[model samples]
Every structure is written in C-alpha cells, then in structure tokens.
Target: MTRDFDDDAPRRLQDAGGLINARRRDEAERIRARQRDDDERIYVVTTNLVIDAQEQLARRRRLDRIWRAGAALSWLSLLAAVIGTGIAWGTTGDLARFVVGYLICGGLFLMSLLTLVGVYFAGRNVSSLQRLEAHLASQQKALWQLKVKSNPDVDERGKLYREEVTTAIEYYQADSRKYRTIHNRHRRPRRLCGRCGQLKRIARNARDGQPDLCDGCYQGPDAICSICSRIRSCASRDEQGQPVCVTCYQRHRTGEPCARCGRTKAVNTRWPIGPVCVTCYTAVLRSPAECPRCGMVQPLIARDDDGAEVCGPCVGFAADYTCKQCGRAGNPHSRGRCAHCVLAERVNALLAGPDGTITPQLEPLAAALADAPSPFPAIQWLKESPNTKLLARLASEGHELSHELLDELPPNRNQRYIRRLLVHTGVLEERNEDLDRIPSWLEHELADKPTAHASLARPFLHWFLLRRARQRAAMRRHPACADRDLRRRVSVALDFLAWTDQRGLALADLAQEHIDDWIAGATSQRRYMIRYFLKWTTSRRLTRELTVPSIPSQEPQDLLDDDDRWRLLQRCLTDDALPPDVRAGGAITLLFGTSTERLCHLTPEHLKFDDEHAHLVLGRHPVLLPPRLAELLRQLAEQPQLRPQLSRAHPGPQWLFPGMVPGKPISTHGMTQKINRTASRSAPRATGRCPPSLLISPARSSPT
Candidate 1:
C-alpha cells in the first residue's frame, strides 16, 4: 500500500524526508480569534446548556433569603395581632371577643401555612436543578467522544477517537471517583491455604488467578513417598510452590513432650526452641508403662514414695479424695489409686495380654533360622557406622521389606559395600538374621527388590554368586578390561535374572548411560545371562527406551514347534520385497528368540554339525538342537539368492548365523522380528496352541 496523501492529511505524513517548507499558518487563526477571545472561549461554547442552572442557583439562594424574610414578617404580623387583641379585650371583653380571637389566632396560623408552602417549592426546585446537571453531563460526554483532537487538517482520527470514547465510557459511566487510591480500588484480604495451611493473599500471587492453598500444600512439592505412600517428597520444588515433604516435615516438627517425663517438652518445633530431642522421643516410644490414674499408656517413669509411678500433676495431690480401694483417708496408695490412697485400686488395669512382657522379634519371614553362616556378618561395623543420618536414612527405607529379601542382604552401616563384599556374600548365604542387624538396615535393605522364594535363597546363592565369587574377584584383578559399562551391565543382567520387577528402585538411578552401554556390549556368549541382568535393572521407563525389539508381541515361543522357525527362513529369503535386515533377522531368531538383543555377538564358529548331531555352541557349550533348526541353517549357509555372494570371506567372526557385516553379525532386533512374523503367520490354525510371543489367555482350569 503505497498512498499519496489527501491534502488535508497532515497527521498521516510519517516522514519529513529532509524537505523544507516555510509557512506561517498559525498567525491567521490567532489573528481571527484575538478580537473576540472572551466570546469564543471554551466556557462560552457550553454556556447555554448550564446558564439556566447558574440562574436557578442564584434564584434559589434569593428564595432562601425570602423565606427567612417572610418568616420574620409573619412573626411580626402575629405580634401586632396579639397586641390589638389585648387592647380591645381590656376595653370590652364580651363585645370584641370574636374579633380578638380571629385576629390573634388566625394571623399565627396563616404565617405557618405560608412558610410550609415556600419550603416545599424550594425542595422541588433543588431536585429539578440536579436532574438538569446530570443531563448536561451526559451530553458533554457524548460531544467529547465525537470531537476530533487538536488538528484541523487531519481527517482520520482513530487514535484520538478511540481514546476519547474510552474516556467517556470510563469517566461518565463509572461510579468510582478519579482520585481513588490503589488499596481502596482493588485490595482483598489474605486467606489461608486449605491444603497446606499457609496464609497467602486471596487475589495476589495466584497461578492463573486460581486461589492459593496453604504453605503445607501449595508451598511444597505435592509428591507421595514411593515407600510409605505418604506424601513424603514432591517431584517439584518447594520454592516453586510445589509439595516438598510438607506433611512429613510438619509431623516431624510438631513434637509433643516426652511421654515418660511429661514436664519436658518432647519434640522438635519450627522454632529452634522447645521439646525433647529425637533420642528422648525414641525412648518415649519404646518405654511403655501405664499411668493407672489416667489409664494412659505413657512412657515409664521412676516409682515415688507411694509405690505409684504418678505423672507430674498427680504427684502433688493434696485434696481429700477418697481412697479408691479402701474408702479411707490416706491409705498407702500404689499405682491406680486416688489421693486418699489405697494401693491396688485398679483404676487402670494393665492393658497387656494374658502372657504379658516385652518380646523383641525379627519382623519378616525367613526360609530357615537354623543355619549359621561360615562368617559372622558385619554386625558391629553397622551399629557403629551411622547413628542418625545414614542409619536413619537407610532404616526409614529398609523396614518395609519382606523377610526373604531383608535377610538376604545386611543393612549394616559404616561398611562401604565394596570393602566387605565377602561379608555381604556370607550374610546372603544365611538370610535368617534380618532383625539381628540394626533396625536401620530394614529401611534401606527392603526397598526396590524382586520377590524370591525363601526356600530357594540358600541354594540360589550357593549356585549363583558364592560359588563364582572367587572367579569374579579374579576377573576384577585382571588388566585390559575395556568395557566397564558393559561389565556394569553384566551386573544388571544378573540382577534381572535374580529379580522379577523394577518396583522399588528409583527410576533416576537407572539412567541412559547404563542402557547405551548394555546395548553396545558384545562380551557375553550366553545371551540369557546378560538378558536376565538387563531385565532386573531395567525400570519401566528405561524398558520403553530400550528397543531390542523382542518378539514384537509379549508371547512366549512354543518350544514344541520347531518347524515354524524353518518356514520363516523360507519366507524371508524367497520374498524379494523383504529387506536384507528383515530376512537376516528372520533366519537368526529361530535359534534363540530372547537373544534378539545380542545377535551381533553371534559368529560362524557357533555352528557345529555332523550327520549324527548339530549344535549352536551357546553359553560356552554345544546347545544341540532339533533336526528342523539344523536343516534351516544348512540351507541358509548355501543360499545367497537375494544378496551378493561372499568372496571366500569365512564368516567365522564366531557368529552362528552371520549377516552382511564381516566381523559383526546381525542384531537381536532382527532376530525378534523374524520370530514374531513366523509365529503370527503359523499361529492362526493351531486352535489352543499359540506362539510364546503372542499373548495367551490364562485358562481358569489351571494353565501349566
């Protein structure tokens, strides 16, 4: 939009463009208005509308004066009438009675009537004047909206017009005065947060204008503790107005006095002052003794002269209370007695069970308690390790674990895990002492582990780690251990096998660094060994990120059916539309469906065969397979219909079924896909029989 300006468009011109113009237009307007400045003044323009109001104001003031004047005249007229009546009465009482009464009473009555009429008319005039003022104000606002601002040449006036109209609406329509203070205009009182109970302004500091909850709720992170299901810590920050262990912190802070010694303030508070320390708090909980009078199970206190462990208040008894048992004054009272003092009053019988005494026992169930370990676990080291910080931290976490798990590992503190790996190994050998270890152990040990059969623990340990501990220790001493990440991965693989789920562990602990290393690992020949470890360590989140593309469906492969796997190689190799990776994958999956993630580790050396026997050397030994799987492999070795023929490249990178890569083999993902496709294609006509890779209904009749 290019535009040449209209002649009157002075405001429309945006730039001067260095063009100079000499003009004297201002003088003409001033010259014309100079002669009748007063007549053409702003007041003159609107004078006609309010001229009558100004006149009426004056007339009303004059009328007020006339009212006073007439009132004075009326008083004077009544006084004269009274004076004339008195004079005539004295001369002739009976003869001038009617004239005296009429003149005196009538004059006063007429004066009052005239004054009332004048006041009514004056009120009417005031009402009319206010109505006229309001009408004039409305008209003034309308005129202001239509009026153009200060430039005579400018035709377009959007900016000025809008501003004036907005002003008219706000100024004349609003009841608020122009000079109102901000506090008076919009301030609201502060309110309490319903959730957290912190006080905040009702309208201010709101998120999207929503009302704020109290500090306990709104001020902290709103997350629940993974262990307790109590709102322990929020995912977000406290300063950012999210939940931050508010309930937990508050519960800790609002401490009551020592139940054992009621006089002492018992708990920690928001202020640095007040209450017993944590030691005293713990003591109060453990020392349970009853106050017979109050029938309250309170902390134990020393017995007094009366043989009663009375609470602080009860000790000063001076009132003439009846002795509960004897009904006498001051009989020697023991516990459960009143001030009159009878000893076995039974005011509060002990709440203990029939066979009552403190019995300390370990909480969780263990497989066997009889077997003592070859070495004592680090019992002393743990007790001395941490008093509060780490011990409290671990105990708070460990206490909820099942017996089998807690016993398997020691919760002992002070011993860095790597320092005494053997001790842990020994203790795991005997999981019967879950409680013998300090309580702090439970909180830390019990979290985030898979369930295990108690009966199997003793044997599993003898097989899995203890028997191999020496081997592992020897391996750790070796040099040139290139893949530390992969080694760490091996631990998870073992963990995956040992455990069933990733329930208790924090997702943050299992990071991407670990996953990438695990996928890159190529050391393990036995894929299941590492696979189990991966499953153990893999959190639900990491599981999604990890894409070994296992049998696409969550079904298990049928060990009974080996022919379907052979069919897969036929379909993939014959189908020209199929990708090389897919065909390679299809062929490899037939051997091990779970080895989907470790296909690259496979090598030609794994394929060993003869007319009598054929085996894929997996897990450092020959895994002899059925004739069908063997036949499929024999066909693949000779076949290259869809790919370039190898020029004497001995595929012996140790791959059982090598693909395009010279040293590297096809990956597990390809293997998984091949297995899945084969399973789905063959599964339709099988009636109840299905591939393990497919989901199956758990039959109510008890599926094996």
Candidate 2:
C-alpha cells in the first residue's frame, strides 16, 4: 500500500499540471465559440420570409401601376380638354355655362378613346410580366427554401420556409415523373473535363465538318500517333498517302520500322471499316474503293441498274416472276418480262390478237402513244382534251406517240377521243407527209405571239425585272457570300442583263460601264465570259457610252483599224455558236449582214445546182454562192464528226446547227462564245497548230 501510493502520487502530480492546462484551454475555446456565434447571428429563415413578402408586394405594385395608367390618363385628359374647349367657346361669344356643358361631353368622349388605347397596351404588358414572374418565382423556389433551412431566423419564418420547402419538393417530384420522357428524348451527353469543365467533341470535328475539339482546343493535329506513340509530325504520308495522327503516328516514323512493310518508312494504320485516316474519309465516300455489295475492291455490277455486284442475269432472279405468254422471267418491276416483249405484246394483242390474249385492253392509250416520241407529250394531250381535239393538237404540236407513251398516259376520262386522234396523227406524222412536225406556222406563232398576250406580259415583266434585280443584289450580298461577295454581285448583274435581253428587252438602253464594272469585279472565267457576252452581244447598241476593251486578240493576222468596227463585228458574229434555224440565223444575219432582214429561211434543198455549181435560193431569188464559202458548207455537210449532228439518234430533222434541247434553239449570243474559245488553247490535249476551220463574219464593220 505504501509503494502503490508513492507511484500514484508522482503520476498524479505530473498529470495534474497537464490536465489543468488542457481543461483551461478547452473552456476558453467553448466561450470563444459561443461569443462568435452570438456576434454573427444569421437569420436565414427570416431572410427568405422577408424576400417572399418583398417580391409579392413588388409584383402587386407593378400591377396596380399598370392599371392606374389608363384611369389616370383618361381623367387628366378629360379635365384638360374640358377646360380648353370651354375657354375657346366662351371666346366665340357662346353662353359660358352651356359651352362648358357641351365641352364636357366632347371631352368625355375623347377621354374614352384615349383610355381604351392606353388600357390595351398596358394590359398586355401586365399580363406578360405576370406570366414571367410566376415562372421565375417557381424556378427560384428551391433556392429560397434552401437558404431558409441553412440559417434559422425570426418572425413567421417557420411557416414561410415550411410552405416554400414543400412547393420546391413538389416541383422536383413533378419533374421526376418525366424520367421516362427524358430517357426517350435522350440527347448525347457531352464529356466534360474533370479539371476545368471543358467539353470534348467527336474525332475530326474541327475542319471538314468533323472536329475532334472546339477551335481553341484544337492543336492542328496530333504530333505523335495515339496508337504507336511515335513522333511523325514532319513525316510524309505512307505509300497510300495517309497522315497518321500523333498518338498513332509515333510507331510509323521513317526511323522506326513500319509494321506492315517492316522497312524504316512512315507507317499508316489500315482499317477494315474505312479509310486509313480521318483526312481521307470524304474522298472515300464519293467513290469508295471497296464495293458495298461484295466488300471487295471494284466488283462487277452488270446486273443492277444501280451497279450491284452481281451480274445482270442473277440480279432480281429471286424477285422475277414468269411471264404467262413468253414463259420467261425478267425484270420484276416490268412485271416478269422485258420492256421490248411488253411493248410488242401490247401492240400485237390490241391490233390483231392470238386467241384469248388479253384483248387489246388499252386501245385508246396504244393509239395515242404510236405518234408521240416520248410519254410526256402524249400525257399532256390527255390532260388537255378528251379525244379528237387532243389528237389534232398533239399532231399540230409535232408530238409523237410511243408504246411507252400509252403505258404512261394519265387517266382522265374526259379526253378519250383526244387520245385516239393523238395516236393516229402521230403515226401519220412519222410517215412525214402530214406537215405536222412543229409546223412552219407554229414557228411563226412562237415568234409572233398574239398581240394582247404580248402587251399584257410586257409591263408586268418590266416591273418584275426591276424588283428581281434588287432582290438578286441582296441575295448576292448575304452572309453566304462572305468569301466571294464582289464576284457574286458581278455575276448577278450580268445574268440579269442577259435575261432581260432574252425576254426581248432592248439592250440599247443599258450602258457598257454597267457591264464592265460587273466583269471587273468577277473572279472566275465563267463570270468573265458571261459579263463579256451581256455587254458586247446583248446590250452593245444600248450602251454606246460604255467602252469594253477588246479581249486580247487571239487572231494572228487580221486587225481592224476602227475600235467600234471591231465591236460591231463581234456583235454581228456571236462568239458562241448559234443554232442553224430561222430565229437564230436571223438574229446573227441582222447584226452581221447588210440586208438579212428581208431574206427568209432557205433550206439545204433551196441550194440548187446550175450546170456545174450550186447557188442558194434566197427569199425568192437565187444568190450566187461564193466558192470558198461553198467549200465551208461542203465541209459542214460531209464530215460526220465535225458537222455536229445536234442529236445523233434523230439527225437531219430541224434547221442546220440545231440546239441540243427541244423547244428552244441556240441563242445568237452563244454563237459568239463558241468562236472565241481557242478550242483546246488552254487545255493540255489541244494540238498546238491550227484547229478546226469554219466561216465567221468578216472582222470589219461600218466606220464609226
């Protein structure tokens, strides 16, 4: 007991000093904490309650303000008007009381009008503001509730906080019900940086419409490949010309051996699905190296029209059905037979049938198609008339009928007779004695519209032209042309002038500088050509003041002395090739010839032989043919390749040098462009020596 006591006493003494010091320090900390809490007394619940009251009061006040504006303005205006009218009436010597009474009534009426206007505008504003406030208050309810719960306060804070907290919870719970909706409308979630909250994009997202990063984040390309971890930024592409990205490029540098070839060359990763690199993605899509059907490079696609890998005989073999009569299966879409068989069967069955063959079900269609060259003309006839008139009209229009036409004919029961007439007339026209091939009279009519239709359209066209020019200018100047703004403007102006000329507007009114300015601003070769044609061909006479410099002369020998004469020669002989028809020829001859106006169309037959030489018959009389010019004509007629048979399939049908398109001949202006295009001059394959020779208008005109 004595020994134990002695040991405990020393230990107690040592602990007593440390324990007392710790106790004092802990007690002091407690006091300091309490004081700090008392000093910064936070009343969050009270704050939220006060804010709620303030927002409600402010909204009510705004509503009251709006409502008062109309009432206040009406009352004030009435008072002012009544006073002024009364004074004015009294000045005119009216009884003052009566005048005051009458003015009061008039003022009241005026007040009513003013009141309504103010109320309309103010009421609308109040309604809009109320809706916005309601939305904002709902959205902010959660924040307010959170603020209150975080800090307790006084003065009805508990009730306000409790009510708002419930509302906030309800709003969230209501939104929670849309979990399925959110999932259903799932947009891709962006991957953001954990460090700085930056988002990542898909690979190759920057240029080429495929960016891997936003503009600021993109470091042109990876310096080293992601896959191989080799540095190859400066290295050239592989044998296939693919630049590997840095992460993958590191393993492929020249110093490092290629995995494929095992040589010290730039490495490229080959993918089974797509191109070697993202840079070549677009190049492959247009003309992919791999065949879609066979998964091989350049598979043969003789069978499907869309170029399927399988041969023609095998394609649609599964889909094809056996033909009843022929017992052969063909294109399924053609109903188990070839188009030729179908056409022949259609013709034979209807006209003179083998027994029990579907008795010529489409008599009207078959007959109508016999004359029409294409189905469009035959269908158009059916659309216009029922029977006889349609055939007459189709024939008159020079439209032919075909087997395809019969099948394609639009079904409108009203014009059955027209179909019959169309079929018979087309068949007769094909025999060529019907005088139905786009008749000379209709040609006359196309040139000469009825006076009334011409008059009606001309003024409207002029107005339309003015409005369109302004609109075209605006479109050319829009944001889409940030790269080529000036060039687009020039092209638009030149196009407008040419369109105006084609619509029969005289170019004589426009000036040359108008065209020159347009050309000067144009950056492309096509635009330059269009600008040149518009001024020199279409509007040269109208724009006498504007001097377009001659395109540098490609012609080696001849130089006209007068500048204006050269311009006249260019106008007379169009730079572009013209159709060899009356309309086209007349325009060219009118400009080039001294008197081509009186002369009319002279066919090849018109050029007759007299003993040894041929002479062309003009309007009525024979003009002596020039030998050299005659040789040029001979060349045009004899050479199959050089003669330019407008349509190879239907040759020698229309006027000489026909247009490729039907319903329109080559424009005289086009003739001028064809002449100047040093055929092959700028192209690689062009022979350096003299090219094809043809007669052009003499390079001289009347002296200025």
* CA lDDT of every candidate: 0.42, 0.41
Number of the top TM-score candidate: 2
lDDT of 2 at 297: 39
lDDT of 2 by residue, 169-244 (tens): 6645667756444433333334453333467432223357543453334434545544455654523355666556
| Candidate with maximal lDDT | 1
TM-score of each: 0.18, 0.21
By summed lDDT, the worst window of 10 consecutive residues in model 1 runs over: 361-370
lDDT (tens digit, per residue) of candidate 1 on 251-359: 4433466533455443532111224555654443334456676665444333466666643334543333234464432222243243222111110111111333211
Model 2 scores worst on lDDT over the 10 consecutive residues at: 680-689
